[model samples]
Target: MIDIHSHILPFMDDGAADYDAALGMAQDALNDGISTVVATPHHANGVYMNPAGEIEESVRVLNAKLQEAGNPLLVLPGQEIRIYGDLLDDLERGQLLSLAGSRYILLEMPSSRVPRSMEETCHELIIQGYVPVIAHPERNAEVAEDPSRLVRLIELGALGQLTAQSVAGTFGSKLQKLSLELCRRQAVHIIASDAHDQLHRPFGLSEAYGVVKRELGSDAFDFFQQNSRKIITNEEVIRANPVQSYNKRHRLFGIFSRKG
Candidate 1:
């Protein structure tokens, strides 16, 4: 499996703290059958700001250690860029890091809600030649309540990724079911570990795949694996023709709730 988003870079952010922790996280992924892990440290998240160049260096050092340890995991440099106004400019000017120097960029938004300007920002990124992939939209309350709000992004040619834990019901049944719904509708593109540590948020993606396979079948398994591989290769992941969504109830609820 190719983990498109992760915070396993040592001392880069609030992820794996040191080289030991980073290697440990890699081992966790390796044991789970993950071969390539994109070391996506938080960038411009208002607290942990890992610059693109610094992240590249961190990956280089980590790769050396992995080689020395004879671990078969490949680490790549990427950034989980928080949604902000100046994203396109920062990326174009070489201030933002693409996924291992590819056109694919992993994007994260605020937790509670989807930003109003997010759709426009993604469109702008598309215009500027970057694929803006929203990370972990399943955990967003607004998205969970009304998943069709994400359809606008898909219409604009942007892709969506879900947290592996969310699919496993680590958050709750609402989020877990919503994530599967997105996959069923072909709205979700990739599933990533987004691991922080081995205790609370350990790197465990295999079990999540098991859940998906149980609920969604082998096709869903292939979807997550194939699409993640494409993102690693910086290739276009066209949606499996948009399915009919069972979202009319959600649309009505959203409308009635907003009438206050």
Candidate 2:
């Protein structure tokens, strides 16, 4: 499996603290059956700034270390860029890194709220010939309250990636339910272990895949797996139909709720 989002680079951001920790994280990923991982350190996220060149170098160094340690996992370069006003400019200037150097970019929205210019920004990215992929939308507070916001983003040509921990109920039941709902509605395009460490943010890709297969089915699992691979290979991903908002009555009265 290919994990498109991770902070495994040493001393880059709030991910692995050092090379030892980074190697530990790689081992954990290997245990989870993930052979390929994108080292997506934070970039322009207000606190951390990881330029594309630096990220590429870090990936190179880490790959060498993995080879020395006899680990078969392959680490690729990427960035979890925060949505900012200069995103297009930076991307055009070759400062921003896409997922495994593919056309798909991992975009991170503020956790507190979706930016007011989000839709337009994503539209601009699409216009610029880049696929904007929203990372961990289920964890965004505003999006969790009104999932239709994400549905709208999807309608505008943006893809959504859910964190594996969220799907595995590691964050909480509410987020797990919301993640499942997004999958059922076909709003989610990928699943990634936004793993930060060996302990707290361990790789849960296999566990999350189990949950998706059990709850959603084999087809859902295949869809997510194929899309993830496609993104890394710069292939055009298969998109599902536009997602609709869940009925309010169903929320209040369970599955037996009648349409008004």
Candidate 3:
């Protein structure tokens, strides 16, 4: 399996602080059945800004360690890019990291507020031929309050990726419910372990898949996994399932606690 989001780059960001922790995270990913991981250290996230070039170098070094350790899992160059007006410029200038160096970039909106310019930004990114993968919308407070904003982002041709912990109910019952609701409405395109370590943010994409399997079915599980592979390969992503929209009222219902 391919884990499209992870902060495993050692001493780079809020992920691993050294090589020992990074190796531990890699081992955890392997145990979870993930064979590949995109080392998505936070980029342009103010406090922890990792550049595109640095990300490539980071992958190179980590791969060397993996090879030495005989670890089967592979690390890829990528970033959890923070949004700004200059996205297209940087992308055109070859200053971005995609998952596995594919055309699909993991783009981040502010956790505090869902970007109001998300629609236009995504449309522009698509026009530029780079697929923007919106990171962890289920955890965003604005979108939690009003999922219609997320619905609109999906409509504008951006794909949403849900965090594994969100599905496992790590953030809270509210986020877990929201994450499942996103799946039910087909608002989410992929499920990834946004793992930061072996403890708090453990590598557990399979466990997340289990939750998705129980909530949706084998079909939904395969749909996300298959398309996630396509995204990393730089291939055209087949939606697998038809694009489904949610009723506005359902968004409000999703914000509250889950009875079941």
Q: Pick the candidate with the highest lDDT.
A: 2
lDDT of 1: 0.83
lDDT of 1 by residue, 93-117 (tens): 7779878777788888898898999
lDDT tens per residue, model 2, 66-182: 999999999999999999989889988999999998889999999999999899999998998889999999999999999889998998999999999999999999999999988
Q: Residue 223 in model 1: shift from native, Å?
A: 1.3
Screening candidate 1 with a backbone cut-off below 3 angstroms (N, C-alpha, C), the clashing residue pairs are none
lDDT of 2: 0.89
Off by over 4 Å in 3: 240-260
- Worst lDDT window (10 residues) for model 3? 251-260
Stretches of model 2 off by over 4 angstroms after superposition: 243-260
TM-scores for all candidates: the values are: 0.91, 0.93, 0.90
lDDT of each: 0.83, 0.89, 0.82
lDDT of 3 by residue, 1-260 (tens): 98899999998888988998999999999998998888899977778768788889988999999899999889988899899877777877777777887878899999889877777888888887778899999988888888878887777778889999899787788888889877766678888998888899887899888877777667678877887788778887754222332325454333221323
Q: What residue pairs clash in candidate 3, if any at all?
A: none
